[model samples]
Target chain A: MYVILVYDIGQKRVGKMLKLCRRYLHWVQNSVFEGEITEVKLKELVYEAKRIMDEDQDSLILFKNRDAKWMDKQIIGQERSPTDQFL
Target chain B: MYVILVYDIGQKRVGKMLKLCRRYLHWVQNSVFEGEITEVKLKELVYEAKRIMDEDQDSLILFKNRDAKWMDKQIIGQERSPTDQFL
Candidate 1:
């Protein structure tokens, strides 16, 4: 499936969360990531994320789609980190 | 269209951006918002966002879909703000 993950982590653990997410998905912008992954990999990514997050203060949201083509994306300002680097 | 808007704004201007986005979309979490809006309204929101943003330093991304049913949302941790409050 294709997924877009957005996170709001506590300042102290955000760096760790970023590193963990980078291993599984493309970092699209600050605290935002998106890419295609198998169900197993997605679960693994979420497992790691839970470790880096404080349930009381941090939030993590995942938007899933069967494929990227199902959605349309637009950018109005600087593309901090382009997800289509290879393409 | 149903749109999910994510922003990474400089600290100095983030508050203004948040206030502006709230008027057009549901606040799902920190720096993230989603809701149904007409094309004209989306354009207006983008126009206002551009004014509050520094093109060189900030980034705004919009993910649009024909309907929210096309995508799935999963929250792993705290949902800072619930989007389906009315539902």
Candidate 2:
């Protein structure tokens, strides 16, 4: 599945979460990450994310799509980092 | 349906997109706007967004969920803004 992950975490924990996510997916934007992964990998990412986050303080939103073609994307301004080399 | 909209637009056009989105949903975070919207309203939002965006430069990603319950959200750090008063 293709997953879009975004998170709002404390300054102290942001680094950890970033590292955790980067290890599993592409860091497309600040506080945002996405890419394709197996069900098992997704679960593993969530588990690791849960362990790294302060549940009461940080918030994470994950959107899963069967494939990227199902999504309609529009790009207008300055392009930051590319979505992903593989995507 | 519930929609989660995120955009990476140019500085000049972002303001316009923000205004268009704020008129319909809550501005939860930078570049992220989301809320419950009807199919008609969703189309309206998309139409307006397309007009405001620089098709070649900006990127918009919309995630639709029938309901928030289908999502697993995790919060870890400082909360910037409430998701929405009603949600």
Candidate 3:
């Protein structure tokens, strides 16, 4: 699936979350990541993300589409940390 | 269309961006928002967002789908803001 993951983590744990997510998805900007991955890999990413997050304070939301083609993306202003390589 | 918007703004201008986005979309997490909107409204949002952003330093991305059903959303940990009203 193609997933767009947005995370809001406590300051202390955010670096770890960023590192973990970078291994599986493209970091498009602050607190946002997206890319295509298999089901198993998605599960693995979630498992690791959960371990890094504090359930009481942090939040991670994943928007999944069967494929990237199902959605349209637009960017205004700068394209920080571009993910065009994934395209 | 259903849109998921994420933004990275300079600290000085972020508050304004947040306030503006809140008027047109549901705040789902820090710097992340989503909701259903008409094409014209979406264009208006882009216009306003551009006015508040610095092209060299700020970035805003919009992921648009024909409808919300085309994507699946999963939340882990605390949901900083609930957007069930839009659903």
TM-scores of the models, in the order given: 0.92, 0.65, 0.95
Q: Which TM-score value belongs to model 1?
A: 0.92
Between 1 and 3, whose DockQ is larger?
3
CAPRI quality band, candidate 2: acceptable
Residue-level lDDT tens digits of model 2 in B1-87: 777787888899878888999999877767777688898998898889888987687777666666654544443444456754333
iRMS per model in Å: 1.2, 4.4, 0.7
- CA deviation > 4 Å runs, candidate 3: A85-87, B85-87
Model with the higher DockQ, candidate 2 or 3: 3
lDDT of candidate 3 at residue A40, scale 0 to 100: 100
lDDT of 1 at A54: 92
Quality of model 3 by C-alpha lDDT:
0.90
> Looking at model 2, how many pairs of residues clash?
20
Once fitted onto the true fold, the runs of candidate 1 whose alpha carbons sit more than 4 angstroms away are A85-87, B85-87
DockQ, candidate no. 3: 0.89
lDDT per residue as tens, model 1, B1-87: 888899999999999999999999999887889999999999999999999999998999998877778788888878888446222
- Per-residue alpha-carbon lDDT of candidate 3 for residues A16-74, written as tens digits (9 for 90 to 100): 99999999999999989999989999999999998988898889999998888889989
RMSD of each: 2.0, 4.5, 1.4
- Every prediction: chain A TM-score: 0.91, 0.89, 0.94
Best candidate, lDDT-wise? 3
The superposed Cα distance between candidate 3 and the true structure at residue B30, in angstroms, equals 0.5
